[model samples]
Target: MGLDFVTVLFDSPFAVMNTIGLIAFALVGSAKAIREEFDLFGITVVGLAMAFAGGATRDLLVNRVPLVLQSPVEVSLGLLGVGLAVALSVVLRSPENHPITLVADAIGLAAFTTAGAIVATEATVSVFGVVVIGTINAVGGGAFADILLDRSPFILFDDFYASCAVLGGSAYWIMGSVGATGSTAAGVCAAVTVVARLVAVTYSWNLPTVQTLGVLSERMDDQ
Candidate 1:
């Protein structure tokens, strides 16, 4: 990826927005987890881990250095989010207020999905690669957050999160293919992801899981 400073600066505004969103999401998740079981230090670890875990892994997969390493702003926003989470833990005494968590996750997913597409476009990546990176960036944090909380992946159970991210990233790649500018593409992608995720959640749209009995019947039919 031959990204210059100018492009990384101007063409990647979505990256900044997405990075901030991730920080907030990580913090909320971490704070909730801390309030449930962990202490202050553990909260910090979970917050940082969830905040940067996915994008860091994505960068390594794409053979690029992590953005948080190069930008102090990323650290600042992430830490601020974590701090807010810790503070919130002091008052909100119940997990029943999960709406806050949902909102944070949605914002973070939108930002990361857009950022992933932007980065893929800058790298002149294929459509599939763009979608892959975008989806990963969008849901990576949630996956890590759930694991830290000792829960199964959220994407597998609810919210249609990964599908929305993949669709949004696909939209970004399509728009870029038509020669759209970076900022415009990012905005479009973010909007699509946010809308899709909200609609899916609102309507409880999700795929049905297949059980083992159904699988055995299909296999017998094939035989």
Candidate 2:
């Protein structure tokens, strides 16, 4: 089963994206735990949670066993990411907030968003389901990790993050509806998500809050 899973990872683009997402998210989560000064066990737990939470939720929504539970290789990949985070910390101070880690987070988001869209589509869910699942799969792990860290989910009040997944998922649904091949749709979804996230990060873009909008409206009225 392990060998077969590895073969799938090599042969299937979807699986490849899943692998990348797992590793990257694990690293991101582990880094955060390290920043918070978690013990080694806690760090490993957080890393595994970040790597598997979103995918597990997606699988449950689609009525299947979570892939993480089905494969030891998945756990190994996640641990490899955790190991990478530890190594990076030893080499670089505050590696969690480093540019490379941020980039990895964006890539992981894109990969998971694409994976979720593909899985939801295969399950023949509605357009809404596809978008929602994609967004959740992209951000759910981070949210969960935040909770474990005793903080609110950053996505609920944070920068332009989950929206990228929504846009990417919509792109996938539109392209698929128009008869594009699965690969084409997945490619567009991943590209859209990654580009949007990187741009948002580079520019410090964020969605406006209600208070900010109200202030803007008041200024316009005064003008």
Candidate 3:
């Protein structure tokens, strides 16, 4: 069974996307830690947390052992990302906010979103479940990292982020509903997520709050 799983892992689109997400999110997390002047141990912890938290949560939801607990490769990939962030910090003044980091975050978001959608589909979950799981998988890690950094989870108040994952998951479900192959659906999902996230970053797009929409002011006037 282990051999068969290994073979499938090598051949699976899920594996590829998972690898990208692990590395990219680890780098982003490590970069943020470095910017915060965290010690090496703290940086490593944050990086691994960002890489594994979401996947672990997803696995728990599906009643499976977390892959990070079973695979040394997963930890190794996360460490590699941390090393890359450290190296970048040696050269770049602010690696956390660098364009490379921004792009990596977008790619990571897309990869994890697609991976989550694929896993949720395999679990025979409802379409709503797929979107919920996908969005959580994409943003859960970053939220965890933020908490470690002593900040509120940026997903709650940050610019358009989790919505990209929602859009990607919706696309994945729609494509599958239309009889698309799993690979095709996964590709479309990742593409949609990455593009949406990148555009949001580029344009500084943000979802409006109730205050921004004047709902509070209107209610006050009515009272």
Candidate 4:
């Protein structure tokens, strides 16, 4: 069974969620790469970067090898991401705001944020650390890819993006404190995140921002 395979492949809920997040993030990366006119190899590299950059940064900050380097299966997943990137680049005409891209990004955000909360808990971190790690896990990969493409990081501009992850992480931690097991807690937290994200997307909810651009000013100012 699919569930059985998941439980067997991963000894814990975090591992399962992390793996799924990796694949989803990889797809998001590839979509961005295609949009940016990256070559095939570039797409693959971006896929790998988007899939692992955040977790890698988190691990290094904690003084550990990036899981992508330590886990062979994760490397395999990265390659699978590259292969999928190539296929998707051919099939997807519009990478930005495509249903597939939005769904993949939402799934990745849910899975990684919940799993990152679990990791922070296991590491005996503070509540701040839990939220911080979860948010980073959800956005770090995409942020890296955005940097390479010379785009503003979504986490900075997209109000609901990191908010959902933080709420999910907090939910996961609170559920754990209330005697929920890892899988059940993770599920609840991820569900919360996904629902919130989808609702935000549907409603176009956004935090207020000042309109400003250096060279693209609508009203030219006299010096």
Best by TM-score: 2
How high is each candidate's TM-score?
Answer: 0.83, 0.95, 0.92, 0.87
Specify the poorest-scoring 10-residue window by lDDT in model 2. 5-14
lDDT of 1: 0.76
- Give the per-residue lDDT of model 1 (tens digit) for 121-207: 667767788998888877887788778778897788774889999889988888877999877788888889888887887788977
Per-candidate Cα lDDT values, in order, are 0.76, 0.92, 0.92, 0.82
Q: Write the per-residue lDDT of candidate 3 for residues 1-223, one digit (tens) a residue.
A: 8787666555787997898999999999999999999999999999889988999999888889998999888888899999999999999999999999999999999999999999999998888999998988899999999999998999877668999999999999999999999999999999999999999998988887877679878988899
Residue 16 alpha-carbon offset, candidate 3, angstroms = 0.8
Of models 3 and 4, which has the larger lDDT? 3
Q: Give the lDDT of residue 169 in candidate 3.
A: 96
Provide the lowest-lDDT 10-residue window in model 1. 1-10
TM-score of 3: 0.92
Q: How many residue pairs clash in each candidate?
A: 0, 0, 0, 0
